[model samples]
Target: MTEYSEISARLAALSDDQLTVVLQAATAGRPAFWAVRAALDEMAGVGNVTPGTDVSPATAAPGVHDQVTGGGVSGQVGAASTVPAVPVHPAGIPDAPAPGGYSSGGVPTFESVRDKVEQRFGTAQGMGELDRQTPAGRSADEQWEAREKAARERLDRIRKSMHDNDTP
Candidate 1:
C-alpha cells in the first residue's frame, strides 16, 4: 500500500480518544501546528494574503487553496472541491467569562481602603509609635555613624566569606 493509504488506514483504525491523544501529540510544541492553523485560517477566509506578482494560483501546490478567494486552485487540474469548513470547539471547553466584573466575592473599594489607611496613619498625632526608642545618650550624627560602622563591619564579613575558601 502507498504511504498515504497506510496513514489513512491507521487514522481510520484509531478510536475517538486515541485520535484526540494523537492530535494532541501532533500539535504539542510543534512549529507545523501554527503553519497548519494559518493555512486553515486562510482557507476559512479569516486572514487576507497579498497576492504576489511572482506566483499565481496555477503555480501553487496541489491541495493548497488560493488565499485571495478562499477557494481551491481555480480550474487547476487535480484540485479537490472546497470542503465545508466547520468551526471546531474542543469538548469540555468552558465559555470565557465576560469582562469588567470580578468572578469571585466582592472586592473592597479603593475609597474604603484609603479611608481606613487615612484613619490609621494620616495624622502627626501617631508619630511617636516605634516599639524601641532611639538611644538617648547619642546624637543623630553619632547614631548614624554607629549604623554606618555596623553596616561596614557586616559588609567586610560578607566580602571575607566570599573571598576566603576557609574561614579562620
Candidate 2:
C-alpha cells in the first residue's frame, strides 16, 4: 500500500544470489544507506550507530565497537589508548630519487627537482629543458631565441590552417 511496502516487495522478489550481489555492492559504495550500515554492524556483532549520530571516541566503547577485519586493531581504535607518537622532520620524508644525487646521509633531497622545475618555468630566458628542443650545451639567450622561433612557427602553421579551412 505504502511506498516503503512497495519497495520492500520489489526487494523481496529478488533471488538469493541477486540479493547477495546487490547487498555487496550497496555495502561498498553506498554507505549512505542506514540499512546497509545496520546490516554490517549486525554481522560484525557490533551495535549500530545511526547515520548522522555523532558518537565520539570517548563514548563509542560501551555501545559500539569499530568492527575491523584483517588481523586486529591494536591501539589505533580507541581514545585514551596508550600509543606513543613519533615526530618526523621534513628531512626524514623521502624525496624524489635522483640516480647520483642523494644528499643528507643518503636521504634523497628535493633540490634536484626544485632546480629542474625552476629552470623549466621560473627563469625569464632559460630553455630549462624543452624550449625549442635546443641541443645540449646551449646558452640561455640561444635557448630563448629558439623558443621564440618555435612559437612563431607554430603560430604561422595555425594561421595557415585557419585560412585554408574547407568549412567556410
Assess candidate 2 and give its TM-score to the true structure: 0.18
User: Residue-wise lDDT of candidate 2 within 59-107, one digit each (tens)?
Assistant: 6443323333233333355634221222222455664454765764685
Q: Write the per-residue lDDT of candidate 1 for residues 79-108, one digit (tens) a residue.
A: 653332223436576433224332223555
Query: Model 1 TM-score?
Result: 0.20
Candidate-wise lDDT, in order: 0.53, 0.56
Q: Estimate each model's TM-score.
A: 0.20, 0.18
Off-target runs (Cα >4 Å) in candidate 1 are 1-113, 124-145, 166-168
- 10 residues in a row with least lDDT, candidate 2: 80-89
- For model 2, give the RMSD to the true fold: 22.7
